[model samples]
Target: MNVTLRTPRFILRQPQVGDAEPIARFLNDFAVSGNLARVPFPYHLSDAKAWLRTRVPGLPVENSNFAIELPGEGLAGHVGFHPGPQGPVLGYWLGQPFWNRGIMTEAVIASLDWFFSASQAPAVYSGVFHFNAASLAIQTKLGFTQTGRSTLLCLARGAEVEHIDTIMTRSVWKARPK
Candidate 1:
């Protein structure tokens, strides 16, 4: 089932149609969308609506997705896992206003805590475009280690970009700081 995770300052819950407005607004900025592999730049309300349609509820936590909400700010962004060639991949993005405030870091820790506790997967895979040093730093703080590099299509940039692959094994996550 789609799980709802709560942190001291944020709520991680399922995405809904109402979240489309903020999703489009935040992702429309190239600074935000360009770092993401799947989102297109100039992201529109219709695009968010279409993507939200795919977030089927009642799916297991492994396949579930979350809309990151600040207490009074509505949808701040998203963090969730989806199927990848190797295993479940962690993916997330935040509105520019919410950047650098440790919002994503808190949400990610909560999500990973729940994910590792609920599932038996050996590891979770994630990566950032090579230029996204900020994102890479967050990954590093969470004990995710670089696995390799590969070129991946960045829809917003409309070209291939270098991606630094990383993985967090169960043991590392189990030993993470609380």
Candidate 2:
């Protein structure tokens, strides 16, 4: 899958070998490490390498994984979809330094557009930890609605918690402003 998406301030492209160090740094940030479900604290270069080598390629079983970059800056975030039984699950994370700048929101909106255009997915969904208000806000801004909730054990967090699952269907997507 050849996937490259652009927003006004960011470019969403495929991950390259060089992205490992930056990604590792992003993952190690306390703000990110504490909020995200799978990212480990004290994230390592080797961990980043393994993730890029294994997980990055499997992204968007129907579409692709994208490295989110600000123009002139290197990678600032990541946003993508993974195939699901119903449709696709959206996921994203921005470097802490870039938070509150609307960059992630822009990247996510562009990714959803690409997903709907490239795949047969009738809907896209994402699960946000209860405390991730920023992420919840971003999804809501993109027209995703709270569909349900579930409790899952987060091994990385070493706890069981409730998470809100949000979804946006094709019908709703088609009605969104261009």
Candidate 3:
């Protein structure tokens, strides 16, 4: 769908036809793919094409994806919610060049505010790989509490690895300390 969400710095908008090349460029990096479950190493143009094909523009918010775009850098990252067994699951990544700036956190906050405010779901779930301290911190900062752990397949690493699962209820979101 033609959804265009904005944070103070970036535009969370639809992934267009031309994003595949840049998507392949940034995602081909080992650092970017290592923490992800589905992105394969040496990512190809076809891989990007497959992902874009799945993301229909008009899909509802809970089932959609967005390119994290800056005015100058264009597609700097990606973020989105996918359906989970219990509720919606949050996922995101920023290219290595854009790391450590709190940009992903802002994107997550804005998207979830829209998700939580717009939907009637009870809560949201997220899982962070064991070594991804940054992602764990982001989820915690957003009030997601640890639910458990599991070994999930990693397309990049080509194996199942330890993942920390977390959940955040509507009440928790509403009561988050400002």
By TM-score: ranked, best first: 1, 3, 2
lDDT by residue for model 1 over 21-84, one digit each (tens)? 9999999999999999999988999999999998886677667688999987889989999889
Q: Tens-digit lDDT track for model 3 on 38-125?
A: 7899889899999999987568767878899988888888988888777788889888999999999999888878788878878888
Of 1 and 2, the candidate ahead on TM-score is 1
Q: By summed lDDT, which 10 consecutive residues of candidate 1 come out lowest?
A: 56-65
Error of 2 at 64 (Å): 2.0
> What residue pairs clash in candidate 3, if any at all?
1-57, 1-58
Task: Please give the lDDT score at residue 138 for candidate 1.
Answer: 93
Mark the regions of model 1 whose C-alpha exceeds 4 Å error after superposition: none
TM-score of each: 0.97, 0.91, 0.95
Instruction: Candidate 1: give the clashing pairs.
Output: none
Q: lDDT values of the candidates?
A: 0.92, 0.81, 0.87
If both were scored by lDDT, which would come out higher, candidate 2 or candidate 3? 3
Clash totals, every prediction: 0, 0, 2
Instruction: State which candidate has the highest lDDT.
Output: 1
Predicted structure 3: clash tally: 2
